[model samples]
Target chain A: MRILVTVKHVPDLQSQRSFTGGRVTRTADDGTMNELDEHAVEAALQLVEAAGEGEVYALTVGGADAVVAVRKALQLGVQHAIHVSDDAIADSDVFGTAKVMAAAVRKVQDEAPLDLVITGMAALDGLTSMLPTALAAELDWSQATLASAVSVAGGEVTVERHLADAHETVVAPLPAVVSVTDEANKPRYPNFKLIMAARKAPVALWSLADLGVDPASVGREGARTVVVDASPAPPRENRVTVTDTGDGGTQLADFLIEKGLA
Target chain B: MTTVAVLIDHRDGEVTRPALEALTLARSLGTPVAVWLGSVPSADAVALVGDYGATEVRVVDAEMRLAGHAAAALGAALEDADVVVVISTFVTKEIVTRLAMATGAGVVVDAAGAEIVDGRVETVQTVFAATWNVRTRIHTERAIVGIRPNTTQAVPADTPGDAVIVPVTVDRPATRERVVAVEPVERGAGVPLAEAPVVVSGGRGTGGDYALVTELAELLGGAVGASRDATDEGWISHEHMVGQTGTTVTPALYVAAGISGAVHHRGGMQASGTIVCINLDPDAPIFEISDFGVVGSLFDVIPQAIARIREHRAG
Candidate 1:
């Protein structure tokens, strides 16, 4: 049961996030592993540990700051880490990113085949939820996404997906892409032993050349869509905040009734 | 005029609100063509779509709930179409992304509005957890867009059509993943959160007691909602969670009680028409976005508000 878990580096949700040149601004200190991707790391570790004889690898694609993401994964007990970085990788859309990731997975598979690729339901920064499907299509592999619970046995993986309308049990063959939701499991806190080991571990860094990807086919040049304009939406008008008094609740009722919303 | 394919989402023989909203949006771009997947559309469903400006309804029988097969079928059915529109849900985003990748079409999801400006698809959407609004353009020959619900008004056509139903047969590619079993999740009483005109939500300040929150919602004829903190603490089921990853709703009136308004929670309800909040801390971020806010304990504020509303109704 060789598994690879994909992680992303995103700005902390509490921070004042802004865009630079129509792209999300990222700084080394203000970033961490995407909150949702921790669930994917947890899923991969659980699948390998349960098998009793397998390895879990963590992979991330971004700038130098993205190394933090894979390192965070290592603190959770992943054995190997890989970071794919290049100047041309910046400003790439989901398709371009997926293409770069698929190439790196193939290179890893060449040395030793991986049976699964686990990912978060979506990267919180974008919240597009398109990467898992794009990565599956790029690798021509099966995809079972938005899984609330997952288990693997008999050369197959099954996942339970909870959608708006139904709870579905879905099955796919080996070498499949699976995305787990926050409901999948509670992510474990980093262990002191693993944290010490992860600090000294060497991470393999790869570029577009190492992954056999064209530089021009990625980055902004390869983007399918273009951002024509970006600006903050105007703030709400005439906001009112008052300290509670005896009449506070009555004031609330009067406002709602005045607006005919009650 | 260019052809626009609108994916009509239907359940229990009724067309969903977002699909109708998509049709209303589609008419602004070009001719509206309704694409119905899975269960066949009933006569009433067809009539409703036709009244909303869809002249033709194409029915395809297959397990479209799965994204892969749906993508393959859509690829074949939309060879002549120039633009595709669907509701921005988790499953539909995947389905359209696959089609967009296969056909070299640019894709956008969670868009508030999309239009064909100067022969290109341009869209406006909220970013950074709904704090900023950004506009994007699709430079590809074809485009796919996932529109959010409650963002557009459904309008009737000046002249209705027959909405002629045409059966489509396409050799959809075989998918490796298969749905083995399915169970319907039971819905709670009153209106569903997404469609409710008024929503009253609680957070950690409630201390796991939903009695007052439920009372306020019931009094306003609204649905109950819970912040991620409340849901995580088992105060409410996951179905009632409202956040970026959970349910995103745009009700007419949104009331938050005891919620500190994290960025995740704000994204779900920031676009609501009228916002009101009750929290112990006046400096909570939720107060910044609230149209009306009261700084007090929810326990005291909600019960009193409910009583006052009842008095107003009686008077």
Candidate 2:
């Protein structure tokens, strides 16, 4: 079995992010490596390891920073790394990003047909969580989102989903796309040897032209939705009425009463 | 008439709240049509859609298929629908997203609110982990929107609208993946995080002791929440994690204990109606946005608060 995992690089949530005149700016404090993508990479690693005789390829689209994300995937257990790079590919919205990724995946599949494609359920930076869906549409594949557990065998894939009210178990055939949730598994730390190897590994860089992608149909221009304006929400009034005081019973009751009823 | 597709979310034949919210939003976008995929529409489900101004209710027999399989059928009917307003749960997001792409329509997710702006439907999204609110206008031929539940109240219209059952075409793709089985979670553990009115969250400062947080939540009849640090450290379950990388909650009241109020953490619960903080550090960031704050340790404050709640109950 061959597995393909999509990874992304974004300002790490731990880092402080600020926008200067509508553009997001980041600093060293902001960590990177699209956190959710880690879950995807981890899932791929576990699946390949479980198969015992399979290959896992990590793919991403970005700039030099993206190489770091791809390298991290290698360290985590991907046998190879494919990083699609182009000046035109930077800063694309969800729709455009999905298009570029689809193109990359198509090129990879040409060389190595993937039995399964895994991605993080959502990127914390965009929070749009639309890429997996868009990619499935472009590739015309079945999709399972928010998968908590996935096991593939006999050309069939079984998934456990974390639903709003309950858990749902689903079984689908192979050659499908699955977006993993954080609950799926904890991402493993890359070993030092693999990290060193990742540093030395040659990351395959493909441009839009190299991938045979039509720039006009796959970037910012092709986006169906565009942000008009973004602003801070209106300030909320401060209504801090402390209720838990030293008094055990009366004060608690009084606090509730002051808010409305006693 | 424009066919507006509404994904009816249900469990055990009972329609979920967010699905009704989507139905309400669908009415404003076009001629409302409710599409039930997994099971036959119960009388109760049909009535809910009828009350919400759905002109038609389309039910596809698909309890045995993978979740995404039924979406193909709905997408065909919605190929010409002016708009599709899907309840944006994790399940529906993937299905509706595929439908949106297949139909070549514009897709928007986590839409908190929507309206016809300048003759085009415009929607608001909580972007950058709720740090920024963005409004986008949909100018495409078809609009696919994922609306956040509870953001808009679902008030069924007084007048019952016309209902029609249309034939839905299902094209099962030759996919290798299928759902083998489903195991429902235990019941009545606590309020569903999304629907809970009050949430009591603990952070790294709890030191792996959730006993107090649980006690406080039980007293208030709320759900227990955790920061990413707690979940990452294995001190609490990931289900309790609430942050930029975790669940986004908008409860009526949110209580933070032993939390430093990291920016990522704030992104999750900032939308709450009221925020109260209990931290040992007077300078903790959680206090900045908190409506009420106590400068003390959890060891001191939580016990006192729980004791007070019991006292009130006894008195």
Q: Looking at candidate 2, what is the lDDT of residue A103?
A: 81
TM-score result, candidate 2: 0.84
Q: Per-prediction DockQ scores? A: 0.73, 0.42
lDDT digits (tens) for residues A20-101 of candidate 1? 7788889998999999999999999999889988998899999999999999999998999999999999988889999999
TM-score of chain A of each: 0.96, 0.87
Task: Report lDDT (Cα) of residue B28, candidate 2.
Answer: 71
Off by over 4 Å in 1: B218-221, B310-315
True contacts kept of 2: 0.54
| Steric clashes per prediction | 0, 16
- Best-fitting candidate, measured by lDDT? 1
- TM-score quality measure for candidate 1: 0.96
> Which consecutive 10 residues in model 1 chain A have the weakest lDDT in total?
A16-25
Query: Residue by residue across B159-183, what tens digits does model 2's lDDT show?
Result: 8775666657577755545555566
Clashing pairs in 1: none
lDDT of 1 by residue, B1-315 (tens): 889999897766789877889999999889999998877788999999999898888888866777988987777666778999998888889999899879989899989899999999999988886778888998887999999887788787788877989888888788888899999878867777776778999999999999998988888888899999998899898878888888888888999999999988997889888999999998899999999999998887887888888988999
lDDT of 2 by residue, A177-240 (tens): 7889887998999889988888889889889998887777754566676667778665556644
Chain B TM-score in candidate 2, rounded to 2 decimals?
Answer: 0.85
